[model samples]
Target: MTLPDHGGLSGPEEIARFIDDPLTSSVLTSMADICLVLSPEGRIKAVSSKKGSPVTGVVAGWKDKVLSELIDSMSTEKMRKRVDQLAKDAASPEVSPPRWVELLHMLGQGETLPVRYALHLLHDKRHVLMLGQDQRPTIEMQQMLLNAQIALERDHEAQREIDTRYRLLMDFTSDSIILVSVGSGLIVDINHNAALMLARTRGDLLGKSLADYFADHTRDSLVAGLEKPVQVGSAAMMEVEIKSSQRRLQLSGKMFRASGEQLAIIRLSDPGAGVVADERLTSNLRQLFNHGSDAIVFSDRDGNILAASETFLNLTDVPSASAVRGRSLAEFLARGAVDLRVLLENARRAGQLRMYATKLNTDFGAQVGVEISATWLDDQFDPVLALVLRNASSAGAVRPDTGSGQDQNMQGVIELVGSSTLKDIVSETTDVIEKICIETALELTRNNRVAAAEMLGLSRQSLYVKLRKYDLVSKDEG
Candidate 1:
């Protein structure tokens, strides 16, 4: 029987055959999957498989069979079900768009491995055209692409969780936290503690610049990334003079990186709590020594006084708060304040407060302190002393003899404290602390520094500066 040309409605095989280009025909013939075209009345039109299929070879012989017997019984179950679905879909008055399914399909010698299939129905929905491709490689490529996408999503999710945890810790942590944009000095973030420390609400702190808090020197140093020395206490605060209502506090902190900003976490401390004025002036060394019995004084280990005992106060008629806060002990020589030298030298030789007598013309008149004693506390060059000046003069009266070493009232006192030098003791004590880390490491550390510079993530040069600041050098075995 002769066939209708049907315009461009030819099947895939027929189209491949009509192509005069040998290269394209050769390529398409090697791999393709197709279905037989049947008219609405159930007559065969053309078989659409590529050239090598045995099924395509038998299409003309099955022209008289009903649609139910058309597919071979030995065909794969997947093919049989697909053919049945297509035939049933054709008989319907109207059918929905076929799902765009891509199946694995092979070429001439292999099984159908991958085929991207799409069925397009005419406006009447009675006739269907199936388009397919040998899509095995394409399907594998797509699956691999999908797997990579899933892995990337998982990694992104994990990173997001870590970022969230870090933010939460910074926000709710107890330590004062301030986030400054490293370049601009703009206060990008401030936690509740930092806000409170600044005496500003978090809202007030958010946009305000760091200049709001820094003093002239400190501010300039910070901008220049230069190190500035700061005192870290509250009682007798190292006052930072302010120009206006803005208060500048001398505080110390470490520079660190956070949230893309180089900021500082300055932990502030209260100076000794409720310490009296005299107690405040006394260097930290004095009170720790002599079990609180020995009267303490802060003077330059060179005898420049920073503080003096209540007895020293009474002996000199100096009020604890006023008369002798910053004045060096030598400044009172005109006021009959006894030279603390002889006793200090004796204490240095003895390592502890040693009893000695001295006749001195103090405010209480020329007096003899029979049990006078003095001792250096530590070897860090701090002005610290332990003294027990005994008022051995006539009760409430001046000493009878105020002349010389042969003075009649001068009493011989026993130097009961031992005879080791103060420096020797401090040197030995520091050695004990330095032994845990290597001597080189300790010398490479600072401020009675940690076990080692490397352990603290600090360079030896930094540690060296700190040791020098604390007056600790190779002499300090510690």
Candidate 2:
């Protein structure tokens, strides 16, 4: 069917035809993704949206609302400026090209959608039309790409920082470090010291074989050492003469795995050169132990003094280590045999005794109260016991025999005062106490002779003699 041309109709007839035409609304709706008719004052006059679009939710109840209420803060000023520009252009004969402004449309649920819009001035000059293209998907894609780029930059920066620190440490250290390829045995990298030791520039030695730099007679040994697996905490030391360095040089090699490759770490040092103990260090240690407040003494398992510090001599009223060496520690302990024997036994059983109350008996018969911290050093070559005696008298008066059991025993002694002579009463009391103590020690040790002897501060023979004297031992134990 042929359509009549609107040019052939009169002015009034054209107006009537245009008002009755469905294409008027259809053309406005299809102009863009969204269409808005805004009054000269920047208020929304009418709104239309494309089917199945995000703008549909945005334009739901926007009619007659101001443009500031319809868009986000960032776009409110842009919309006002566009309306003012259109009003100014309405009076000008020369029409300006459509100006596009990117805006964020505010939806009912408080979500904002990005939209790029252009304003067109109507002939009536009282209203303007806005055509928008959805910019949400484009903006989201750009943002995601920007985030990925930023992460890539951060990774590169971190790797560069690590490389800088590693390079600084490698160059600053004095030890020669060489990285060799396990597959080809070629030098992969070398520090400055290694290059200087090899008498070759680093660039010249970068790809050279490790064994080629050693003396002709030692090349085979170096090659064999490279083939050996490197175990942690184990090192193989050998002597090699470099071509430039005529002196015998010590080479120690150990195996390590890094970045999926096994490599040998060979260190170079002067032969027969090692850290020697400084005389001042030994002097310091001697002064520390000999003059310190705590008296330190070293003894054998049998409680024979192996060595005694000066503090020990002062505590025991001895002149020097010579005065106490090889002497039984029991002679100086106030309890005689009992204290030293119990100390050694406990040190062996528990590795250490923290605080054991005892008395240091001086040759002048003065008793110095002390607490002993003893440790048993079970050395393979020279086993010994180390005792640290701290002065306990300074803390308080000497500890009294104030137990309930001791009180009762004293009471028994008191009760015999009127019944018998002092000598007879003392002999009877001593026998009864000895028998009870022997029985208690046997019970405490679960009938073990060696342990019981140690607990009672007696030799095995002495304990057996006492057991026989008191008839405290069973036939099986004897």
Candidate 3:
């Protein structure tokens, strides 16, 4: 087993002895997944696979078969050429490195195995040694990487589609919308409508402070309101005048979190932009509805109150417009459903009813004679009846039988004459007159109980007693 003093075998006899050793096959199988001894004509003379290799049983029957038969048809010519080249190299005197070729081996049952084979020239020169590395694991790794790339591309495409939809919605919406960063108070994004509203281009608006477009006095309040938590029943919008145009607009905002950062989405809209053709005319009409002397009430087709102006609330003795909203308008009519039915019928038939005489019953059980003008608004989306009520007594309308010179209060008392006994009528009339006088005094004194008591010639304690009896004691007063 010992070699001569040289690093390699000394003669052909020693090399042949080493190749025939029992350990040589084990050594070759350990170095490669599969080892094959091929004849000069490319036929498989012998086959050996490493222990526990996947191709061990697959290649077991390949001995004495042509090498090209075990591989796929595509690899047949390549195998032939490699074997021919190896045979030529073996016949030459020059030594060369082993040549490696990748081949696809056709395993039966529609399966294929990839193997990288290196052709080694044997010392006998009549045969070639083909050592192959199992490329299945490497090929499987490459397939896994390909699948991952495909999945990534699909996910990227899906993300792009979502982004495109979001952009379209933001651009096409009619409302003026702007996105601002909470930390920086700077504009992050703005839609076309918002840019037009602010009198600026989208490029000029981005990365700029939102307050820069608003009046100096309102900038701080506007930003603070945007950052505050939204509350139900809170004022959703505020009036702001644009610095450039001096045009007033309603600004409303909502706060939301995105990408782990806080953002504010604000909407700026003209108060009368969509509702009317002329903004100034709309403003004038709005002021008239809110502050006019006449009471105005909007009711749905079903006679339910949709909205009420400030004067309407005052006339009905209600605390706020919300208190009467959604309630049947019949509740405030003197004859209840009878009066409401007549007003609705007449308005619908004629498109408008002019100065229909009726009485409005207040929450405090007092009735005021009113002349109602009802107009049917047949809006396609929201049909409503607009009723404007003028106080008949304040308008100096003549009272029937009570004489033109008779006061309205006395006329009301006189009207109850035939319905009740003399004593009952007197008692009720006294109470009614007293309550009216007390209310008038309070109104004249601007709700100052002390001054009202002085004006009414009553002590503070007595005034309080009468206030409680009339249920006119306000929460602050109590």
**Would you list the clashing residue pairs of candidate 3?**
none
Query: Which residue pairs of candidate 2 clash?
Result: 230-255
Write model 2 residue lDDT over 333-378, tens digit each, in one string.
9877767777787788878887677688998999998988899999
Model 3, residue 6: distance off in Å is 41
Query: Which stretches in model 2 have alpha-carbon errors above 4 Å?
Result: 1-33, 72-74, 86-98, 108-110, 120-127, 133-139, 142-161, 164-174, 183-188, 200-212, 215-227, 230-241, 246-266, 275-478
Q: Name model 3 segments beyond 4 Å from true.
A: 1-28, 85-98, 123-126, 216-224, 232-243, 246-248, 276-478
Candidate 1 segments whose C-alpha is farther than 4 A from its true place: 1-99, 102-112, 120-130, 134-153, 164-174, 213-222, 225-248, 251-478
Query: How many clashing pairs does model 2 include?
Result: 1
Clashing pairs in 1: 103-114, 103-115, 104-113, 104-114, 105-112, 105-113, 105-114, 106-113, 234-271, 305-329
lDDT of 1 by residue, 162-270 (tens): 9899779877787666655545667777777767666778888786676557445344555443234443332221334233445544544555676665765444333
Q: Scored by Cα lDDT, where does model 3 land?
A: 0.78
For all predicted structures, in order, the TM-scores are 0.36, 0.46, 0.50
| lDDT over C-alpha atoms for residue 318 of model 3 | 94
- lDDT rank order: 3, 2, 1
lDDT of 3 by residue, 1-478 (tens): 1112211212223223435865665667677877777777777767766666666666667777887877887788788787778777777889877888889987778878889999887768777778899898887899999999999999999999999998898899998999988777889999999999999999999999888788853445766876564676343466777899998988888878899998888888887765765777888989999999999889999899988999888887999888999999889987677567767876887788777666888999999888888999988887899999988866467533322322666777888899989998899789877977787556434476776676567999999999999888983264
Cα lDDT computed for each candidate against the true fold: 0.51, 0.74, 0.78
